[model samples]
Target: MWDACPIELARPQKCAISEDRDKLYMDFAAPLVSEDLTLVEADPFQLMVRNGNQTCTIKYTDPSNAILSKENACVFAVNLEQHVESDLILSPTRGCKVLANRNETNLFSLSHCEKHQPHEESHFVQIKPHNKQCHTYCPESNLTFEGVNGKCPNDVWVMPMNTNFKINDVQFNGSRISIVHQETLDHVGSMKANMHLQSSVNWISLMYEINRSQPDFKPLPPFELHDYTHYVSYSFCVVVITALSLIICIVGKKLNNLPQSD
Candidate 1:
């Protein structure tokens, strides 16, 4: 007799499909744990990018937020030629003038109403001493006798003199008389000495009287000379006089003795 009907076919097994689904989930989860991940905000001033072997810097005036936020971004280089213009020329009338003198040169005249201009047409006046008073004849002589006197337009009087005059030495020869005057002026102005010969002794007397009238020009304190040669000469004179007197006395004595013999 044949086997009753056929043995019930076993249901297709679902375990293999379940095992495949679980393996797919594990593979996706493994990548998430092993891969490197980073999150950072973008900076407005700087940009960074990765090159083949090194990092490059990108600088730009203004950049979009999207570009800055992108990972590995760089700034575009700018050409300055298109952005710059030529320099402008400024006129002289735009500046200021502080101090000005009128007696400097011909160009500088006394005009109070004239205003100073800057870059256009400007003139500078400088007052400089011409050393006209300094005597070039004898610098090493140290006998400077000169003074300066001038008047400004504003009625200002400038009397420049050498206050350092001193009598270093005096030589009185009939023909060539020399007197040394040493002096230093307050400012580095000019110095000069004037000498006049007078035939009339009255001029000298007048000068003496005038000098006497001025109390400030009085004679300085006397200076004593302690010369050894002078003292020696005085002692020598005294000894010579004493020796002469003794010789005369001895002669007289001899004469008296001879008379008695006669």
Candidate 2:
């Protein structure tokens, strides 16, 4: 007699896959085996990755898209962080205010009183960038004349005046005059008077007053007198022609008066 034998086999284990690709997929029936697996995620600005017990961070703009891994760390794939808005505003028109004063000799202070009394001018006022100093002139008079003292920087003392002097309308030595204030009557004065300072307070102040009355000031080119080359050439030609005519007249007169031999 022979006995019948029956055997039962084990069923395969079920498997499940994670929705996120960053996670690994495995089946219950699969044997546990150690293998290196890398999970990566990317966005416009940055890249993140996770590997066996490690995390890697990368920038999208990097020249090479090489994978980076941490020595020992955990990785997280997070949404891009929002950047805070800047709180800065710009103005349409921007400008700076400047106070400029011209330095001059025999500089007088003007009174804005209705009577307009002229103060006894003592020391010359020298207004500068940092401070104002009282300078003494040669004669210490209202009509002060500046000379080449050799102490001035340019070897000349510039007389800056807020008076009526039309430097633009005057001409000198093959060059135009470039006065500080040309258009405004308030700053116009005789170039000679300004250079020589031979005018009275009333006259000088009048020029300054006129300039102040004007609303707008437009600079004019200084007067320039150039050499008259054409005139000189004409004169030279006239002299040459006159000399030639004189020689011809003398020769004609000698020929006419020649002695006749019979």
Candidate 3:
């Protein structure tokens, strides 16, 4: 009947890639969710964290073929999707700044993609280190202390006995903290619920998550410590001592001027 129509071939065309190396990605920390919800599982979507060892892809190929619609398909409506997860894999040990992973020798030597550590040419003793003020200290024992909400690092439990609404028996178990809810002043052991904890490092976190809406939950300000030592401001303390001394002097003089009895 008829010889097959002449075979047709599509020509190969190279994708044009243009890149500006100036752009860079930065770090972000999402706010921690509340304790009422538990994160049984994460998205399982691995996102890359950028650091000094890697550079942005100075080049990428734009895919050749573009799909278009019969109507409303124009240059303005076009969106290009690329495989952005592609990245260079560096050794787990290389360019790591973590103190445990890399020792002082390595950490101190790291440039952090900068030119060099400050005063690299000078002796270590010559550099003055940063000084931070300590909120708590013991002069007798020569011990320096750091704390949050007036609680020492060793005693970090948050007790909620004094709130307008009360939370009871806050207990930690298996990546969760559970507490009872009560409206009255006295502690109640009846109601209990758990909140999810996302992560922790050196410090304990108060931020947590719960499964359902926790209407009773409210974030409170940092604990206010009391001055049990009967502390007065320096100026007021000085004034009180001076007044007492004057009164004592006057009374002693009056008594001494009187008859010299036993």
Candidate 4:
């Protein structure tokens, strides 16, 4: 069971709802005929459209937790005459909106790099992506060459990985390394790359010398901290002498009071 949905078309083509409600049938009058495209629930909030080998994803934006219904789902109708792989087409329904495609450029690459003089240690390069968003994503597969620091090879292409999806600066080396802030995306110097190569041996030697010659700063307490060594020794001697004198006096008194044992 299906209801008529509003559809806007740039050219002449008829879109009809299927009986099963899982597919959208597109009919091109006369000689041009195409197969039905199926739409299935990919997840709770996502729908996948299958047009032979090609599949396009659609996300449900409604805030409410409603089941997949005809009101919110649509299939993208792309090229059909050549039977070329296109996004899915689904049965139409009321209150549906059509999203049209436009010409959007997605580019990512290091435009240029050079060192002015043969003996110059500093090199200037230009990094370009279609936009700042692409710059954030290009570093992952582009940015630094293979190997670390001085050991990098010249001929090797930037580390390879899957770059099929959307490109953004954060998706690239952001995880592995720091990325430029959003505010810097529009800065004039954003594309400038200044690389200065330093000698590892010299760096290590300098660090070692700095560490060895560093002055050791010890923490000192706030109080004066008098020793009191003589006071302690004298007090201990007085206690011992007093104890001996008391013992002697008690012994003498006991002897005198013995009452002539004889």
Q: Which candidate is the best by lDDT?
A: 4
The alpha-carbon lDDT assigned to residue 237 of candidate 4 equals 100
Cα lDDT computed for each candidate against the true fold: 0.28, 0.30, 0.25, 0.32
Candidate 1 lDDT over 112-224, as tens digits, reads 21222332111211112112231111111223233322221211112223222221232212223232554443121111000011111232433343444443567778876
How many clashing pairs per prediction, in order?
7, 16, 12, 7
For lDDT, candidate 1 versus 3, the one ahead is 1
By descending TM-score, how would the candidates be arranged? 3, 1, 4, 2
lDDT of 4 at 134: 26
How does each model score on TM-score? 0.16, 0.14, 0.16, 0.15
lDDT of 3 by residue, 1-262 (tens): 3322222322334443346755554434333322222111111111111123321111112212122111221111112344223421111212211113111111011112222333322111111111111122111111111211221222112223222211121211212323454323211111110011111121111112221113455767777655743455666899999999999999999998999768
Q: Which one wins by TM-score: 1 or 4? A: 1
Q: Model 1: runs farther than 4 Å from truth?
A: 1-201, 206-223, 227-230
Cα-lDDT of candidate 4: 0.32
> Model 4, range 1-262, lDDT digits (tens) per residue?
3322323322447888888899988865332222232322211122222222322232322211111222333332222333323433433344322332212211111222222333121121112343323222121122333332222122212322323222221123423333354332322221111001110123243333333333452445676545686788889999999999999999999999887855
For residues 168-255, write the lDDT of model 2, one tens digit per residue: 2221121232444433231122222232221122335434544444446455788765578778888999999999999999999999
